[model samples]
Target chain A: MSILVIAEHDNAELKGATLNTIAAAKAVGGDIDVLVAGSGCGAVAEAAAKVEGVSKVLVADNAAYEHQLAENVAKLVGDLGKNYSHIMAPATTTGKNMLPRAAALLDVQPISDIIAVESPDTFKRPIYAGNVIATVQSSDAIKVASVRTTAFDPVAAEGGSAAVETVDIVDDAAVSKFVGEELAESDRPELTAARVVISGGRGMQNGENFEMLNKVADKLGAAVGASRAAVDAGFVPNDMQVGQTGKIVAPDLYIAVGISGAIQHLAGMKDSKVIVAINKDEEAPIFSVADYGLVADLFDAVPELEAKL
Target chain B: MKVLVAVKRVVDYNVKVRPKADGSDVDIANVKMSINPFCEIAVEEAVRLKEKGVVSEIVAVSMGPKQCQEQIRTALALGADRGIQVETDAELQPLAVAKCLKAIVEKEEPQLVILGKQSIDGDNNQTGQMLAALTGMGQGTFASEVNVEEGSVKVTREIDGGLQTVELQLPAVVTTDLRLNEPRYASLPNIMKAKKKPLDVTNPDELGVDIAPRTKTLKVEPPAERQAGIKVGDVAELVEKLKNEAKVI
Candidate 1:
């Protein structure tokens, strides 16, 4: 079978989630083609060609696709996706916005956020906020699915050489216009891609007190995150939240501090290889999932932890 | 301008769901159900638009069993003018629900349609965008802020990286996010008044839309449990365990 894996990029570099998606496509046992749809994204297309499992890369460079708007990109995907057996993308915000529209255009039901590929037609996904795992089999002619990147190990970024082809299809509905964006600027690594992640919660008390965690994170070269409570309490922006509705990370090391582990927060970080929790409440549900637990006040523990590191 | 807001009745967010003994599905037999939180935000947004004199009327719609009408009434109590219940006993996926909504959209021809970004139950996050596609309308999903102007609406979306603002022409689809606005609780008088609001019921067959499942669930199982490890006494012991035992530091 031939599969089309949509590449997620910002015209300059390919996102790591695309690599993980490629790994998922490999597990589906198909000849994979990467589609890079963006204006002046030749560099991204070239990078996609180098991914180990990709057989080919299709570059659709046009101003209409510059911002990856759903109205325009969905039309292009719908038109081209008809020829493929399966169309897949990483379950990110961009993919989530565009893929379902394309699936509806094709009159096919989209299977979202699949965590395991049981077969070409069957997959396993999390439902009810990851509390239950459901195995679903698709009966549609062409399967459209989104891969949960954290569930799949990413393929090598540099290995193979694939031919790059230009696609001259432009389908702009012109019903919507991109106004602007405010992306977070961080010197540290991206949360989902980081190897080490340190997060705080409501127990952090206030926004300014996050400096203690930040100091430890800097020493460990880890990305910093916060719980839904912390975000709602105005301790951090929504993007920093780690929960069912926010970004899911499966880092090698996940350290949660002063966070009374709610089930929603656990859903995001329980998959980490190593989990450490420091909370004064010994009965905090987060300690149940943590590999190591410390029952101590964060105010005294955080400073000592930073100094120890 | 007329506005259409869609709501869903789901398992309450606070309830801890578990798989049944037979593993057929999550056992919500006696669990308390409520309006999905994001849909409440959608209804609140529509009410605010009406309060600002931008929306002339608000129509709240839901597709499910008879019980979903309760959610629609909740929306009316929150200031919606009327309600529509697309009653069905069939298990509706995102595509089928979108088809039913598309039929309603075609008949109502409202200036704007708003829905929750994702229900807490399925967490599919697809119905609004799929409905927009089926009706050939532009969509603004995961909306944090919405402003209605002449013939257009500007939506600030909550994306993975941060926020993005997009301007869609009228008759567009917008999905609500957590930060959109705080939903006001319904007063006792408003709850009583909602019973008098007009609520019309229709079936999917009357809309001429096929509501069939495209995917079959093989099984449903609980996630693997993570066991809690030993508790450390002090910061130095925690550091030692990370470095020597777990080697994760």
Candidate 2:
């Protein structure tokens, strides 16, 4: 049986989540292949071919594939669906957007954000926002699933390389016309790719108060994040939100700032390698699960810590 | 312009989840159900469009059992002009839902179709994109902002790195993001008025569409619990432990 993994990247650097997804796909039944669809993503496909267990890299290079629009990708992938036993992607926004459509086109069930893969056809995923796990089994010939990257470690690329094939498919994606793109400007790490993430909450007070978080976050090359509370309070944009309804993160270090660890928020970063909480109210629920708790005015402590870093 | 907004019924966002013995689904029998949060955003966006005079009729559509009627009523209460229920007890796959919706679009011909980025229940953000594909229309997923201009709609989409805005021609599909708009609760007057709104009930068979569920549930269970890690006392100690012990810093 052959497995197809959809690559997550910008035609240059690959997200670590893709490697984690690769690891998960490898553990499951099948010979592995990675599909990189973009305009002139040769470098990306080459890099992906080196990932451990990947037997081949399929490249679909065309201007129409540039957007990664779910409609077009789903159609193309689904059209090629007959060749693979299972098609999987990371449970990031893009994967979540594309997989279901492809599954639908294949006239099969598509499992989302799978947390555990037992056999080739059986998988476990979260329902009710990480509260309960649901095990899904596909009797269909080709099973489609989105892998939760947090559940697996990123695989290192082995020395062997794989062949790259160009896929020719008509672009059925008539979605939105091309428009302007404004990238989030930041000096620190990107949230998903960051090794460390420091997230603040409503307890931070106002926008200016986030300076306290930036200090500590900068020292560690960490990305600054905000709880839904902080984002709702207009302390930051929604892009910075880290919670169950927000972004699921697995950073090496997750520092929660002035945040009570609500279950919703914890659901997002609970898989982090290490989590630290700094809050004045020691009784705040964040302390219960925090690996480290600091009960002090973040105002004083953050600056002090910044100077040391 | 006529609009169609898709919604899903799910466990209330605040409800804590527990898995059933069979591991096929969550123990949802006792939990309160509400409109999926993202679908709520889609409803809010459509309502705003109506308020802007960009939309004339707002038709809410959902595919599921008779129980999903409550979600339709909830949408009606939130200012949707009407509701359409495609009766089916099966968990319709995204592609099937898209096919069913394509049938609806062919029949209703709504100028715009709005949906949540993904259902909180399935967390599959595929229906809208798939619908666009099945119907051969434009698509904009995970929209944070949507502007209805002359003949085209401009949508700002949320991405991992940042945001990207695109423009689409009419008869398009747009899925909502968390930042799109805050959903408004139906006022008492509107809730009372919703009782008089038109709610058409039809079976999926009537739509002449095959919406057979393609995937089956083997079981449902709680995730493996993580052993509580140790908690250090102070900031200095915490930093030291992180650097020296966890070795993550």
lDDT of each: 0.94, 0.83
lDDT of 1 by residue, A1-309 (tens): 989999999999999999999998998998999999999999999999999979999999999999999999999999999999999999999999999999999999999999999999999998888999999999999999999999999999999799999999999999999999999998888899999999999999999999998899999999999999999898998888898888899999999998998888888888999999999999999899998899999999999999999
- CA lDDT, candidate 2, residue B75: 95
Model 2, residue pairs in steric clash: A104-B95, A175-B138, A175-B139, B23-B219, B23-B220, B24-B219, B24-B220
Query: How much is the lDDT of residue A87 in candidate 2?
Result: 94
Candidate topping lDDT: 1
* TM-score of every candidate relative to the true structure: 0.99, 0.94
Worst 10 residues of 2 chain A by lDDT: A169-178
Instruction: List ranges where model 1 is wrong by over 4 Å.
Output: none
**Model 1 error, position A118 (Å):** 0.1
Residue pairs whose backbone atoms clash in candidate 1: none
**Once superposed on the true structure, which residue ranges of model 2 sit more than 4 Å away at CA?**
A170-172, A307-309, B21-24, B227-232
